[model samples]
Target: MMINSDNLCMSCMKDIGTEKQCPYCGFHADSKQIEPYLPIRTVLGNRYLVGKLLEYNGDGATYMGLDLSTRESVNIREFFPENIAQRDPKTLGVFVMPEKETIYNECLQSFTEMWRKLMRLSGLSALIKVRDILEGNGTCYAITENIDGITLREYLLRNNVGYISWEKARPLLMPVLSTLGTLHASGIIHRGISPSTLVVAPDGKIRITGFSISPVRSARSELKCQLYNGYAAFEQYGFEGRQGTWTDIYGFGAVLYRTLIGTDPIDATERVTNDRLMVPGKFAEQLPAYVINGLVNALQIMPEDRTRTVEELRAELSASPSAVAGTGVEYEPVVPVTVKKPVAQRIVDEEDEEDYTYNKREAAKKRHNRSSAVIAVCAIIIVLAIAFLVLWQTGVIKIDNDTTTTAAAETVEVPNFVGKPYSEIVDNTYNTKNFTFEKNEVYNSTVEEGYVISQSVDVNKKVPVGTTIRLEVSKGKESIVFPTGGIIGTKYEDAQKYLTRLGFKVEKSIKLNLDNEIPDTVQGFSLEEGVSYEKGTTVFLFVWSEPETTAPEEEPTSEDETTLDDIVDDTIDKIINFGRGN
Candidate 1:
């Protein structure tokens, strides 16, 4: 008889009786699996399997797996303790309580659903769901798209490799701000926003993850334990947990501060009482004033004192002088040469060392010669000074001043040229004495074809003479003609790329139907055969479903049909008693 042990393999549910390791995957039988389970190999669920035992405080044992389906690899999680507890419900509940587990499971399910709805509403791709029950276990599995880069915490620990320069931090902060805006608008507060949860992708995209401990209105009891130590707001620690958009605002500010200055924000409670908060410039002198001010507003103790929304923060950052002029570096003028003098030079007594040969006759002769020379030099200098003055006054020795005068010619004002033709403006309007025109193409909803959609400088703004006014000419509404490029039997991914290059976003959907010749190809599209849409419009594509192949129409021969039925019966028999005693 097979004796059941506490260690059960999640995959086949087999007991390696008295053995310290799994006979199938070699997973250590005695090790606790949740924290540092060694990932073993790939499994049938399109997953990279990590085999180990899982423990539960509330939620059940989780098996970690890597999903290979998406453009980027994703981390998949599976709960195994639920199955083990169900098998021996009487004894298992004594050790691993079931009441709290059930509550935690329900909370996880609700949070997952909420996340799915929010992602969909925000126009982000829905996370892929993996079927767990079909694997003949109570284990539930979920797949989340994996980020290619390091976590924000890891990034900071690396001495902020990418964030040391402000130029690098600007692009990094944009997405963080954008995501916060989306989360805040949905009325779901991310009470915990820290470096560990924010993952930076290889493409410079920042994705916020790890919502396991996140609080929802449905799970009030779990909120108390959900407080992240360094990241949680002060209101979260109080007896009455106060969570709002401001909670996330404070977190976002903390992340920005840590990224810019290599330091975290002060505790919320401490900041609330303290009048003065440290700014970014103090820590990193290279930081610009506008950026420092923006961070300060975001980290303000009071919600009302902080930026109302991420968009407002973005606008403030955009309008700052530092934003347009780049990081602000203060300039110090050079001191004048007249005010600085060399140290006093030491004098030598050369006369005292000279030979004692003082002759009165020679001295008298030298004096007479010196007087005659001085009289002659004075006469010559007087004539030269008179001539120089005459020449300077007459402008003969004129000095050419290169400095520009205040009354220099001014630039012509740019007129409202939105409705004017590109060629007309290029040839006539901007071809005036002091101005020139440069053309650029852009998509505009209101502006007509070939007309100026916008300009770099506003209308009536004065610019220096010979300045080139940059103009954005309307491309009229962007349009794309559908392609009939791929062969009838080409794969979906290749076909999708072909359409995407022509300025169309592809949407994939599977349809169940029967077709022998076409098998599983781009069956067709929702749009008409010959219709054009504005560029960037989503094009939904459908692939043939499994039913088309599973239930084929060509009648089988007697012997063949019988063989197929026999195989089906065997498969069903194996599934029914896969893990049961023989």
Candidate 2:
């Protein structure tokens, strides 16, 4: 009983030598290959049914997998360094002797401290939670719950949607702002907030992901991480040692500005500084004025002028009239009414002011009436003028020297010739005279179909009416079949010319590299080696590469020859044994 490569027992760490099942744990050893990394499905840890590879980044490669014990789908991120020396500080220092390990350690410690501070912050528990840490072959891996959503970058591209509509964008942006606020309050700064780092879920929830350059509270202040140019603050550009809440505020404003306007705010930074920021109404008119104003204020170059807290923005949004609807508030209309005064009271009031008040009321009423009358007369006159102009321009009415002309002029009646071919009319009847024939096409049912249908001019009338008579003729419906051609293996450029000569449009040709074994020609096309197409139809071809071109070639110069012994000695100032370092 020989055991195959895939049928290995976990406990014994050996191939299961021919038994009905694994003798160790009664588990079937013969499972399929999972992935490139894990060749065998069954492993020492609770067997995770390997699924599709989700994504890969500097942190790790994430895969969708199912836990056998729990029977639930889980995301597993496997972090493997492409080159161990790149990731391990100890090895990096040995390989690249000029590099400092203390600097690397300090950066890592800063990031770790920031992560702990952020995790302790309130309201961020659900946003990010450390699940577990697993130690693998010489490296550490952190496994977290898979965030089910599309990256903000993808969502923007797929929908051709941008941060234009506040109604559509508010949900996606509020959460990110809330998260940034929490981080700021906890004295942690997420120095990066680009579109790629923001993830928008199907439920409209947003989460900030990548935390590489995140900064935390430090004892000895010194800026360490590289500044993200796209979202970096002015202070970052100046290389200031101190970064506080305002630094994160700048990044948040940048992200918000980018989401609303398709481009980054800094692109218009000059315009903003020069007081020439384009009005949001010009791009998306439906966006509320106040919202645009708030965004512009937040993106102010001077950090002090910008909104200091996310709570202020949230309050402004909540207070907007657009946010309220159907909240049990009823609107009432106010009506004005006049009440008659009692005669005794009127007499007493009039005695104090009488004649002057009476005269003023009369003048006001008269002025109102006169204005109404003037407006009515003007409107009537304008209406009449417009009616007369319309009638005159359209020639609906015309007056002439005490006489009216009804445009009765000379015309010619159409001849009833039903069964005439197109050539006969041009050669015989309408030929030898001052008249010409204009050919046209028309569908006829009553008339014999292939002859003249009708004419544009009338049958017959009088004087100065010598005009060319237009004719309608038809060709009997006929169909022609296109010929098929031969297929030949040739270069792509030559194949196109050959197909064109055969009256076929070369639609597409895919070229594939070939090895020395196969000829560097179109091995074949998608069609039957060589096939002809209709006169105007296109032909598609596919070319494949040979093994020689597909394989990678070894370098002609070896590493020892490429490196100068003198330069190596000068850099290191000593000879170190690479084999003994590990």
Candidate 3:
């Protein structure tokens, strides 16, 4: 293998001459990387040149990497489950413990599957894009795009007020709520939703990242759990509790609370023992009534009593309350309403206490009238109750405890949609009448076109009527045509964006610009122009590397020079002055 040392520093991917240390980034090219982590410049999949270890948890380590096929920088997530796995020093492969091999394989599979699903959901507004998935060195790797932004935590700390107003937070948080809803619909629950996991981009939009397998997010699992103190839900702390979308709702509400109230809420574990969180009274004046109400409901200690869905949470936050009724709670009266105070109470003024006279006779008369009306209503209710009891004794009216009330929504069993023709699902009233179907078309070689490949909701599962079931219909084998014109000599960023918008992954390669070519411009594509390829094809884009420039060294001048004798004399004078107490 030939090493290309000219115009490239592997540590920082900067253009520099062959040197041990990278002057641009202070990275040493020949510095020994820590064991268990891949060595600097170690290539994965013969494409990604791995760099420094960015961060790691019990699940795996993330590294800064450059795609050799494309000159773009990317984040490579390697699945090295530290709990049950070890690194082979010589081969740089992960070695699982003798008894934990099955667990390791399962976790690796989970890491792979999660990234694959996230790859399908890449275009979500706030989700971090998963570029590709690879299996190498006895483990799996997920390639995610490097986002240039600070965490929501840092963003909040940088704010002058320490907290954000409801008006400012609504727009920032609503998009994330929408993205979380989409993730839930796709059967992905972000149990670790928090300000730390959320990145605020340069555009001021939030990007959701920090995804891991279920065990890493839950307590008492095989791996070490990484739960955010105040943001984790109560259910996450227990193994028996079933975690779902409601779990993320708790974390989301905590993030919102931190943003709006300017402090971390009580941790769910502590709240269980002593449930009290103090949101400042001033925040009530700053935030809307419904926004606070939504936060309270979402941050409920109990899962069943909490806001169960993202749509419900969003609606609640937006002043449209959709309260979930628990065992004894009634849903109708939960909507907050403003009421006018009585005229007598309204008339009280502290400053004008001596000016107004108390009307004792009027107040007494009003109380008597209200008591008489209440008595009359009670007499009518008693008479009706007696008549109903008499009729029940004579078997005129029978009580049935098993009867379903109008308030309880009727549930229908979900019908099997797999292997059914898409035409049959839409055109047939029997299938379409019970539920609203959301269709996603994908290419599958085995399944015929126009047939349902799979459904999100399982068959025979009882769900409420009008529940949405996501269906993936087949589109046969994909025949995606690569876009034409204005690609070569254009900026690679723009070209990559265009290609990505067309559902193609861009693999960038750097080429030396011998001619007077524009730096970072798209030189050419590996795929032929106007050619059709399968869906999700990696388009290799060769970009022109920027011309190397060396920094000019300055000549030694009298003003710029600092002599050793001058330093010594200054130190001695300081010592003498200190001794003399001058």
Report the poorest 10 consecutive residues by lDDT, candidate 1.
Answer: 336-345
Which candidate wins on TM-score? 3
Task: List candidate 1 stretches off by more than 4 Å.
Answer: 1-63, 68-73, 78-109, 118-140, 160-163, 216-220, 239-241, 272-277, 280-285, 322-582
Report the lDDT tens digits of candidate 2 across residue range 357-466. 22335545775998999999999999999999999889996757788665654333333333444454443311212235687875443343345655555543222334
Candidate 3: clashing pairs of residues: 69-508, 70-508, 70-509, 71-508
> Where is model 3 more than 4 Å wrong at Cα?
1-12, 16-30, 320-582
How do the residues 411-443 of candidate 1 rate in per-residue lDDT, one tens digit apiece?
A: 545555665567655533114434677889988
Cα deviation of 486, candidate 3, in Å? 74
- Which ten residues in a row are the worst by lDDT in model 2? 335-344
Tens digit of per-residue lDDT, candidate 3, span 1-582: 434534566555676676767888776565445556788878898888788776665588888888777677789999987658888878998899889988888988888888899999999989999989999789999999888789998999999877888878989989999999999998899888888899998899999999989898886577756677789888987734579888998899999999988888788877876766755667755565566667777787777556678887777676532322211222122222111111111122223432223355665688699899999999999999999999999999999989957766657667557766677566433245457989999888567677788999987687886889999998977778887888998999999999988878999999987776789998889888789887788999999998766689989999989999999999999999999999
Off by over 4 Å in 2: 1-99, 117-129, 134-140, 215-230, 238-241, 267-277, 283-285, 319-582
Best candidate, lDDT-wise? 3
lDDT of 2: 0.49
Clashes (backbone N, CA, C under 3 Å), per candidate, total 2, 13, 4
Candidate 3's error at 442, in angstroms? 59
Q: Between prediction 1 and prediction 3, which has the larger lDDT?
A: 3
Each prediction's TM-score versus the true structure: 0.41, 0.40, 0.54
Root-mean-square deviation of candidate 3: 31.7
**Candidate 2 vs candidate 3: which has greater lDDT?**
3
lDDT of 3: 0.78
